[model samples]
Target: MNIKFKNFIWGVITLSVISSCDISDNKDVNPADSFLRIYDSHQFDHEIRPVDVTQTADNGYLFLGNYRRDDVDFLGTYISSVDEEGHFIRNTYLRDNNVHPVGKFLVLGGEHYFISMDAVSLQAYLNQVDDSARVVSTIGIGTTYPMYAENDGEDQFVLLSYSSVNRTTVLSLVNADGSITSQSAFGIGAGQEVEEPIIDHFTRTGRELPFFAGRSVDGTYYANGFYNYTLSLLFTDLSDNTPSGVIQGQLDQGGISSLLSLSGDNYAVARFNYGDQYANAIATLNTSGISSSTDIEGNPMLEWAYDEKVKMTTMTLGNADYIIIATTTKNQQIALHFYDNTGAYIAVDYLGFSSPYQLGAIQVTSDNGLAILGSTQVAGKFQRLCLFKKSESELNDLVQ
Candidate 1:
């Protein structure tokens, strides 16, 4: 394992230690002031799997995840606010009368907020939270599943919604105050031949896909997912839900977890090949069409080389893009691989544990640091949230 060290003062550290009575008893697993902070379930026998994180107005971070309490099968939304140095500011759990799994969060009016849904009521809500992890305002948006939501530049948000009953996808415009401005559904007539990219891709004989859409830097929205279990990508104008171009991969039974818009016309996507037992890949999408991913050495992946399932994430620093892939090997060791924008390898770091650990999410903090969150069994018999961070200087050394 290539471990790099940077200057970190120890005197200013204020740690939040978890008690064994509530969660696990093992407390001797500290990482010697390397900027790696792990938070166990100190409050109760529960698990918190973070799904997304955003940089706060004070240059700190707000993490959102799924919180599973003890003796309960339902999972609630969890939020944690931390200082710029990765110190805990506040932690809280948000739940409704039904199942609520938060997908991601965005910053509006210099405040952190997110949209989530309830499984039973099937209604979606926008929650505006304060610095102390308390909800100050709430706005209700009726029954529609948010596939993706992100800032649309001027204190507004653009999101994609999927309607299962009509099997239609809609692009919605939301104001900063959490009100629906307008929604444009994918306007395709039944049995009417349309010459759009997404329409052509989906109209082919295949299984119904839980369609997803993402916006590019220039505000162009594209939809990508499995069409007949094959990878299909398309660009939509969003004016009338009409697609412009389309591309499809030959790989079967694979799905994308996330889509990241790169600096310019290029984009990256994280893929999981269920046909090969959770084997994963990182591919590039552009006007040149789809390109298969390779390692830093340019070697093709026959399988998850580590014999464990892998999850990948992409982020940018300056004008350069990077990817962080977390792999759980056969020995139950959780590891992370760093790569540059071209899919070339950079460096690798190991979490060094003999328990099952699943990667939940990754984020690049405002201070150029890295925040990694996952679920690990090392804390006890069941999984507990494992959160860690590395300083900006140390992260720079990895790619250098």
Candidate 2:
């Protein structure tokens, strides 16, 4: 029996299928202008929603998504490896009825890491794959709240975890041998929990915290209500066993959708309405002093036509100057916008996709291009993976 749920929301059925046309058959056709469509009907039995994609060192692409065999039960997360020509090398599946791998997959060296967080505790696991899609390692970190993982270098990784039980944040450096050297409660805040911590960029001197935007260098943290529209910042000197300061503010009347840092000093936050209409602003902060606050202008970039329910995802590519903002509308259409270092709007591009599809994750590659993963519908089933790339010139043209 097919179970119809809200998760299976269907949109308009329209597919802009681009294909490679044969020059011999049509002399006017340009081979360079050809776009390829690679989809196998037999391989994809049900819906295959792409969660994330990454380019390997060998120039191949790794795609991660969920595979649903039925409307109700047989749902599992899948990872597939495709070559430069989009030829499927191998595919693997992780079947779990309880938790779904909804986040993006991080590929470093030859291993892939993904965060799986559901209603309970957040967990991080390292995935080992053979010639086929076989998971050989599922090493678990027990009860790490708000677990997030990023590649450090080589085969090493850094896992940032927040402990709600202790109200502290822990940074664990993991080696290839699965041994961990941990620094517990590095920041300055006790009785206060740390939210999201990402390795923004590596400096010549050392690694710096790019995720510190809208946060305090003195150990203050800021976040909105999980399901509300309130925004607040709390200060803590968790490094020492001492109490710090707390600052709170309601930056948005609607709801906070996303937050990102510009370089090391400036930051941007997105706010939207509940009805999925367009509305957002970019808030900047200066961290030159011990205590920091939003600029006098409030949100520098405000949009009335921007969809409120549309969640904005951000990524800083190459240098800190180039920031990419990608968002998907309630209609499941994906749009990309680029901003300069000064938080000025630069350019925007639209990736064409049919209905019943939505954008999932965006990642900047080593070459400064983007890897987008999302889901599409095929034969009335709502699970298909799509990947796209835009050159630097194409991105710059959007701003012009």
Candidate 3:
């Protein structure tokens, strides 16, 4: 109810309504129409939860998710700016008067990054915004849990903080006016608590040099079940903290939900799970070190054939070498798996929303198209915001 982006772009000419059932059709009629549901709305009074949607070098569309503010007791996490037809060009709310900002929101370059966590006061903030929403800077980086931020391009940024009280891995480097130019920690075990260290894909193998692929662990493996874990290969030097080489291994069973950095050399691709079943794992390292064994393409049991109750959550690397895997099954359907770059098995698309949709955040759109943010539900009573877009000939026919 406190939405503003110049009053929702001047109230979109008196709120242009278009909700008369077809539910935004085009669920796949081909002709270059690979599953279309362009912009569906559930209004917006309290729930419009989109947690991250980027692409706005003027082509428009920027959204960070969370809503629900009747004075704010809990639901308030947002940063929106839309236009490529999805309308709603301005919306910002990270709340304060007492604090209750959740977490995760990244847009990079044109700026807009977030990392808030205060479930009742665990306290954490590392916000930044600019592109008219203006906040420009804010940092406190302390009590972190779901952390992973990237943009080693020029203005510098790479947060990755996972410290379960000494189970190490800090690596800060954030500048562009937000400060902190070196933080470094990296250890991996003593108290262990690294769970889901994402970033999953970042390129550039020479000029403009950049590199990052993610997956970190040592603890919280299903509360302490599978042990031996390690998946690294971080060669950095986007202009400082020196790490021109690093390659480690030992997963011995499976448990790495995401990591991608293919073609630029030290090969990377991981969306793991052997105990809980999910698959699409591939790892490589140069200067001759780690050689890997877990491609799952030849059907090593489909690496557990999914439905282990939805949770392979994110992985991207496409543009001819393709390798996109986004899972959330158990009938909640959001699957999409295409492989290549040596893993084979190039096509699989499943989008069929319903049953409390849950596929939180995913990006890759410099024309290679794909921008998904999650949270859905309506007839059963309210909960909105589930942005969408997918085209590149429907991700190349779901990986041809």
List candidate 3 stretches off by more than 4 Å: 1-14, 17-90, 93-125, 128-170, 173-182, 185-215, 218-258, 261-281, 287-323, 326-336, 339-342, 350-371, 374-386, 389-400
- Which of 1 and 3 is the better model by lDDT? 1
Residue 154 in model 2: lDDT: 67
lDDT of 2 at 315: 48
Per-candidate clash tally: 1, 18, 3
Question: How well is each residue in 121-202 modelled by candidate 2, as lDDT tens digits?
Answer: 3454545544334566665654353233555566665555545555444555566555675333433233212222221111
- lDDT at 337 for candidate 3? 70
On a 0 to 100 scale, what is the lDDT of residue 76 in model 1? 67
Q: Give the per-residue lDDT digits (tens) of candidate 3, residues 288-308.
A: 233333432223334233422
How do the residues 132-190 of candidate 1 rate in per-residue lDDT, one tens digit apiece?
67777777775465555667765877766555445455667788676777565553233
Pitting candidate 2 against candidate 3, the one with the higher lDDT is 3
Which candidate has the highest lDDT of all?
Answer: 1
lDDT scores in order: 0.55, 0.45, 0.46
Better of 2 and 3 by TM-score: 2
How well does model 1 score by local distance difference test?
A: 0.55
